[model samples]
Target: METSKETSSNLVKRYQRYLKLEKGHPENTLDAYLRDLDKLLNYFQGEGKSPLEAELEDIEHFAATVRDLGIGARSLARILSGVRQFYRYLVLDGYIKNDPTELLESPKQSQHLPEVLSTAEVDQIQQAIDLSKWEGHRNKAIIEVLFSCGLRVSELTQLKLSHLYIDEQFVRVMGKGSKERLVPISPRALDELGYWFIDRNQMKIKEGEEDYVFLNRRGAHLTRTMILIMLKQYAKEAGIEKTISPHTLRHSFATALLEGGANLRAIQAMLGHESIATTEIYTHIDTTTLRKEILEHHPRNIRYREEHKL
Candidate 1:
């Protein structure tokens, strides 16, 4: 029989290789899994036990301990998922007799809806920007591109001038998995982008930051946190109460496109969603609008009968 330490070392090597080769998990995901497993290993060590020696009861005890530490269900679920994957690899590789976490269950989490802003509210926020200032033009351009593209904050910040195809009216976005997708750019957004680009050239850009589209006063790439701060200030100036974030702009963009009768598949492609099912969440059918549509188009409602002699 393999020693406990030897078995653990082998399991760790196999887990890392599995994540890299078989699973194709991203580096960040691999890091998170390693961290979670480290915590489990540490707990086992403190209790004078080894992961190979751990049974269902030990797993249950670990879950109870984590719950008592006040970790939320969603977080606990993620931790459990990491642990389960590690053990599954161990079992498949014949390092363990049976999967110790075969009965482990993830905690249930509540479904939360994405926040969105109304068109009127979006307009009010845009109107609040003072266009006279140079930064105002830049800010307006930022908002337009954000809503027009449905980009994540990181994507927007990392945007490059070379990605814009103003003549073709489309911009190439680098999304998750390093995948690239083309999103249409509105004429207004293109025009604003033109002005921002002109102003951008006037600044003395740092050596390595030349290609970045959005820049700070120092002419470096913008950060995600800075975008949030900018949006918050704009929201406060607009006096709209609904909480807003850079993501809110993305949500508003999707909502606007759906309301304008854009095709679901086209929207999914534009949003760079890997799965169409993920994109389907954005297709919210308003009951009030559906009722109005029925009233307008229903055959029985449309058929008018003249008063007949009785």
Candidate 2:
């Protein structure tokens, strides 16, 4: 559970098992559901109740509480989804007579396009690195791999030296649910990693950490938080103001491919998205980009552009 959690009940454990063995929820998704469940249970505790006894009004109040805490609509929807699933399971097993979440209204979430770094912005960030520092070497490599390969931060952190098939121009990536896929590595990304290797090889590699590809000064695999912090600092130094995170690179990768005329299914496979629907979000970004370009350069829109200029 994230933030605050109440004592978990046996029912929660059983539902967790069902989600894993039966529903086949991926590991990260399972963790999210459990965390959301914690949030729900904690809220219910404050009401002198449990999820098993939660009323429709009680659920609505919980949703408002989550909103008050400033969770975004999409996240609130996910948390409510977890709650709905739990009640559904309880009803399925006859533990409850009614499903309180059945009529619950989820918050509306708009389809917002994610921020993408232009190739120039990417180069600017790379140039901002101070190569004299050892971290600069590793950070540069990290950014290159992230942009070039489009890995989830967890997948990147879990990457192993043996997973790199440099001669074949691919790296074996362990994606969500422990699934494996091969993502092509750009020469530029590989070259940065080569430089990072010079520093990595000289270190007294720690026991059991020898196989991991990216490491901290302590020789352990870099945590996901470390990557988040590093990217923010680089973004600031590069003076690109839009919010950035590991997912931004991944989103940019997909959008770039779509704009370059790559098949949507191909991009989905490369990103290891289980559903094509999950990969379709890039199309929205591509549409926004297309519209911007048309308004900026299309001869017919030139006057309109000038008229609309802020």
Model 1, residue pairs in steric clash: none
Q: What is the C-alpha RMSD of each candidate to the true structure, in Å?
A: 16.1, 14.6
TM-score, candidate 2, is 0.60
Best by lDDT, which number?
Answer: 2
Tell me the tens digit of each residue's lDDT in model 2 across 1-310. 2211333577788889999999999999999999999898888777777677776657877886798688999989999999999889888877778897875666768655668876677778889999998788899999888877778887899999999998866789998657787777765677899999999998777899999999999899997668888998989998989778887888777676667565555566667774445655544444334334323332223433465562
Per residue, candidate 1 scores C-alpha lDDT tens digits across 87-204 of: 8877777668888787554565764445688766776788998887767778878887887667877689888889987787667888854778666665557777888877887889
- Evaluated at residue 303, the lDDT of candidate 2 is 34
Give the C-alpha miss distance for residue 98 in model 1, angstroms.
Answer: 42
Query: CA shift at 286, candidate 1, in angstroms?
Result: 28
Model 2 pairs whose backbones collide: none
| TM-scores, each model vs. reference | 0.56, 0.60
